[model samples]
Target chain A: MDTQQAAGTSVLPADPGALTPAEARAAFRSGLAVPTAGWSRGFAQANLIIVPRDLAFDVLLFAQRNPKPCPVLGVLDAGETSGPLLAGGDIRTDVPRYTVYRDGQKVDEPTDIRQYWRDDLVTFIVGCSFTFESALREGGISIAHIDQNVNVPMYRTEVRCEPAGSMAGPLVVSMRPVPASQVADAVRITSRYPAVHGAPVHVGNPHELGIADLARPDFGDPVDMPEGHVPVFWACGVTPQAAVMESRPALAIGHAPGHMLITDARDSQYLVP
Target chain B: MDTQQAAGTSVLPADPGALTPAEARAAFRSGLAVPTAGWSRGFAQANLIIVPRDLAFDVLLFAQRNPKPCPVLGVLDAGETSGPLLAGGDIRTDVPRYTVYRDGQKVDEPTDIRQYWRDDLVTFIVGCSFTFESALREGGISIAHIDQNVNVPMYRTEVRCEPAGSMAGPLVVSMRPVPASQVADAVRITSRYPAVHGAPVHVGNPHELGIADLARPDFGDPVDMPEGHVPVFWACGVTPQAAVMESRPALAIGHAPGHMLITDARDSQYLVP
Candidate 1:
């Protein structure tokens, strides 16, 4: 089917249906509301951040400084509703949901942000660890969150992000339980894709990255650690979103947790090695 | 000895007699004449590009797109001569020699470029392959050009660089004859230094990269290819200089070939793994 006609159809009634990235994006644009975790398999998903033009340079610098946590996939032109470079998907309504922040407070969860879109907004799409997680799973590493059907445990660490201009915050991380024998393989696999969160930021000791407890997390549900599985921490894409909150912009927007912007771009485009 | 005093005492009659990066840069600023390669032993050497304010963004975008050949070390603001971010080195005179180009033509080679400095000029310091070359040597890979006492063989390739505005040209690659046994080791060693042209662009056959005769190079002298030694090519720093020449800006400035800018930044800063 042609892309436009395919897009005209609403989202699949259930999560089990097969949906291409383009179709999933279309469903999102049509307001077929759902989180994008399992919407488009084998396709790359991105964390979205929308900020005013004045703060674009600072935010971009921050990403550049902390690449592990914020691997920028594409930077859209100011006020551009479509990501022409990355996926040719409309940014306005292509994401199933968005959280609007006004002066550091979450004021609204909008299904479609076309009503709040402005001419001066710049969109930054950052690579999420979902791409690397797929690689790990393919390599036979089991992910506890996927097995338990829970969001990956995320934490705000004592490790401060390299501050850029007015945007500064603690480094945020996501933890995954990995078997000890497969940890080296996991590093080798993820290291090939630096544009995605790359390799694990911390492997054995969680406290080295300033996390005091694996049982307690700043965000997401903590899953039970299986026998012989060690907690591996990676720089999370949610870092920039947290920074935006602490930095307190007059206006900011981001994808709600577990809901990502599905892009037409493939996961392989991000692989370096 | 103090760095300034060391600079004054080390001014030899021939070759300026090997000074540290700081001493060498200070001497270069004070009219000392010499190539910078041998002086800064373990520090990173950079290719310098000075262009007008109008072309800065495009040139930067071009570098971003073509990172293998043109790894950007630091970019100075318009009218600025020193790069405070990279090494706090003076752009106008820290380099051993400067080549001035006007309307795509080489006008003069000067020890210092203060006379050519303009308020609208923006300076770009790009990473050079010397750091990786040093790493290869440390890993016991013998470089033929250093042994033959000639410039590394460089050729203009059929590969087209991603265009950014008016900046676009064929990529230039430097060739090294490596023994077959050391090819894997060479790749591994050089891959660790992404900031310094990274790994080999093309290995083994020169024909693969469209180079017809290995005996004759478009730039630099050809070296002896020992038996069982395969030709390895790397993305050259000259690619951006060639792009600038093609763009034909009214004024362009660069380092004379083999005459690099010695920065206080250590080569260790560029090693990724």
Candidate 2:
């Protein structure tokens, strides 16, 4: 089996870590639609949130007020795609697929959002948990979902996010099972990547976060937990989507679950120290 | 001498560190106008900025793009004075003094901005270097300006700030001298407080940063540096004022040089680790 198969990645470049950000973007723009989990390897992949200019401040405030769940990587001006950090990257056609929402309901999924582009649409690229997962793997920690080639399970928690403006929602978290022996190591490695959902919000106590069952998740698929493992949860970037849906904005667009926009920022750049 | 007198602090409450944020702010509103140097000792004091709603985005973007110099503590909504972090603290009269800028000129310095308050005004409370100064003193690090009972010497460096929209100018930096033996410890301690200008940007190399003379400063008073001391530069919060002045916005307001807004956030809350 190739390295992709060995790592249980869906479809990644031959040299995943070696694939530069430009190559990853080119892959997505060329209609190579797939989950961005293993593709850019060492670079951060971002969640996309496009909203009308009228609601832009509320959304930005949501991210600022709830940084743990929605650590914003960059905010592009209205009618603008490329930001100072994500220079030369297109927001409309990036990330392989886009899901448009209206009034808290999913309306349509499109391959590219060129047709929906509006002058008032503002794009916010938020940091994703993938950066921390990579750090976990680097430290010899085995991620259960990655091992099984399944999507990581996510749950809406009892923890309400610190609200901003008219936006407020429960914190959504992605769960991973780690051997009790390696819990401290997991915390240490993930704490180093704060920009990308750094550190676990809860360790072993899913009930405290309002998580009822590991087998049932609000988003993504569940994974089989091996013995001697405890569930660890990190703030998920999918939060802004939930927050937007709650407020029911007339126009909202985001990357389909798993599909993400690849950025040029190195994952190591987000490391705390 | 009392502890405040030995610290060369201007008029402070009998138990300076023991005074609460509310008491300190009430003192200001009651016309107890003095430098907020030693008052409310453990609480983080703030540098205040106010601009019209039209220019709020540009100003906020400046702080977001240049966090080192303008680390935002909290941003209040337009026409709103209280923030989540600065709760119960009035933005208008709580600051001992306010400076009004019109088309880049200082038109008035008011004790309270109640008359100048406009519905379109947005308040931005930025992290001041005073928090880090306290941290330094806690670590047995001597601050020359505080010891001399004078304002910290600030210089306009040749280093260009990261421009955000219409906001752009040379970076304003505050200079503090450290003993050669304590420079590393100083950096280690200060780096813990990223919200307050973090660690020194440049150490021991004023010419490299385009600073000509240590004794001659663009703002504030110069202090004596003893032998074997090296100049360390930290990004100063006054950078926004410099940027605003250069851009010459139609209307702008900020705290007077020595006067600052005391907030409810504890200085220890900003400690990263």
Candidate 3:
């Protein structure tokens, strides 16, 4: 019974506190795979992107230009498996699942991408929302997605990111409902972790951010918004994937939405302040 | 007469409290053509590198891989005049002097690079030693180069930086003589500013870093190392220029040694801790 088949039949482990990054990776490698959202507690999770060598530079430039939405944590050289500078973690078979994009379309959702991996491909592990979410939880803020057991609602905004080369797209953001009284605490907690989106791009009024409706997100499951709480929007890791898709590269690979690469790096290593 | 001719004939400003970042940039624009070592009081200065679009990504990757030597502050899109994200400052004329490199060789030193500007040129402003120097002074540590009225001693070290595509070279470092009692103070002060080559890469030994002689630097003038003072080496901005030059890009541009860009952004903005 492969991990994918097992995942289809029963609920996978939601609490990754018992597993190491390597163990979590091994489970994925063995096909006991699922989205890595809660798989490895207190460790840094990354948004993965693999592209052909030709488009690597342009994509990197786009990320640099739009740092708030695309904070790059580490990059792997073409054909390289491990980023020694980023805690010596293997790039291959690290994440549980991957989404293969061909010519701007999601073509396949595979458990392991070793078959699709190419020698000319460059890998980028960008900052993910999980890091900041952990920080916010530690600061006494309860995220509704965790409680509701749903994916955080993500939307494509009207805000245009600074373009670089052939890479240009609207900024995509993820929303979390926050109590009005705890808004200041949310900002203070997340601001300390700039590597992972760092601070909210918009705190209130989804319409102001070009998000027409809070309940109708372009991606992910929309969570309930209480009356006393306001919807806060953060620059999403999905922005890069959206940019890559719009650019229409011959081939691109990303983590299957919530599936992330768990790195050996500690979350505290990213706290800038 | 232009500012350069006037600057060569007069004693430069010594008071660190003389000018603000905005005033310094304005002065540079109005022909106060001098190396910005001490002009902008309490402001962090930056090393500028302008490269053709074809090589910008490789250079950026090189910088990211070797952050200890090339801490990037802001990167501007090709042909863009202002970096509103870093500071709303014009890059072309903000630096006091610019060095033009053709096929890895120095061609000209111009006060303004408006004539050499190209539509496909990308600009990168890297953190400079001035940020740390200011912190050291604030902590009551005296820098020998500033005291001796000479350029900081720089050496080409044997340490090979992590290579990126088309950009790989030995790490070049700048040395400052710090008193034995103040070495800790220097580290503590500089560690707070990682955006600037944070902390000393090496302390107390020049031979370990492969420098044969303290008085004879590979680049820049050597300052005296007094008794009970150790030579502290920091990863330098020169590493990127060396990497770029080694790659032999057909066209590359950089700030002249000692000369730097004065941005509207304040130094305090870069203090990480």
Instruction: Residues B66-172, candidate 3: write the lDDT tens digits.
Output: 88889888788788877753355567766777888888888998877888999899988898887767778878998777777676778999889988889999898
Clashes of 1: 0
TM-score of chain A of each: 0.90, 0.91, 0.91
The pairs that clash in candidate 1 are none
Please tell me which model should have the higher DockQ, number 1 or number 2.
Answer: 2
Q: What would you estimate as the lDDT of candidate 1?
A: 0.79
What lDDT tens digits, residue by residue, belong to model 1 across residues B1-273? Answer: 345434555354344325567666777766665544445567888888888877765676577668889887776667977755435567887776788888878888898898999998878888888777777888999989877867677888889998765789889898889999999999988888888898999998788788999889886688999999989999988788888878888998988766788876788998875
Of candidate 3 chain A, the 10-residue stretch with the lowest lDDT total is A1-10
| Model 3: TM-score for chain B | 0.90
lDDT of each: 0.79, 0.82, 0.80
lDDT of 2 by residue, B1-273 (tens): 244433434355566457778877766766656666666888998888899877877787788778899988888888997876667877887888888998888899887899889988988889988887788998999988877878788899999998866888888898999999999989999999988889989999999999899899987788898999989999988889888888889988998766778888899999887
- Runs in model 3 with CA error above 4 Å? A1-15, A85-93, A112-118, A179-182, A226-230, B1-34, B79-120
**lDDT digits (tens) for residues A101-164 of candidate 2:** 9997989888678888998898888898888778898899988876787777889898989777
Q: Is the docking of candidate 1 incorrect, acceptable, medium or high quality?
A: incorrect
lDDT of 1 by residue, A36-145 (tens): 55556677888888999777756766776688999877777678788544366789888878989988788988878988899999888988887777778889998787
Q: What is the Cα-based lDDT of residue B179 in candidate 3? A: 88
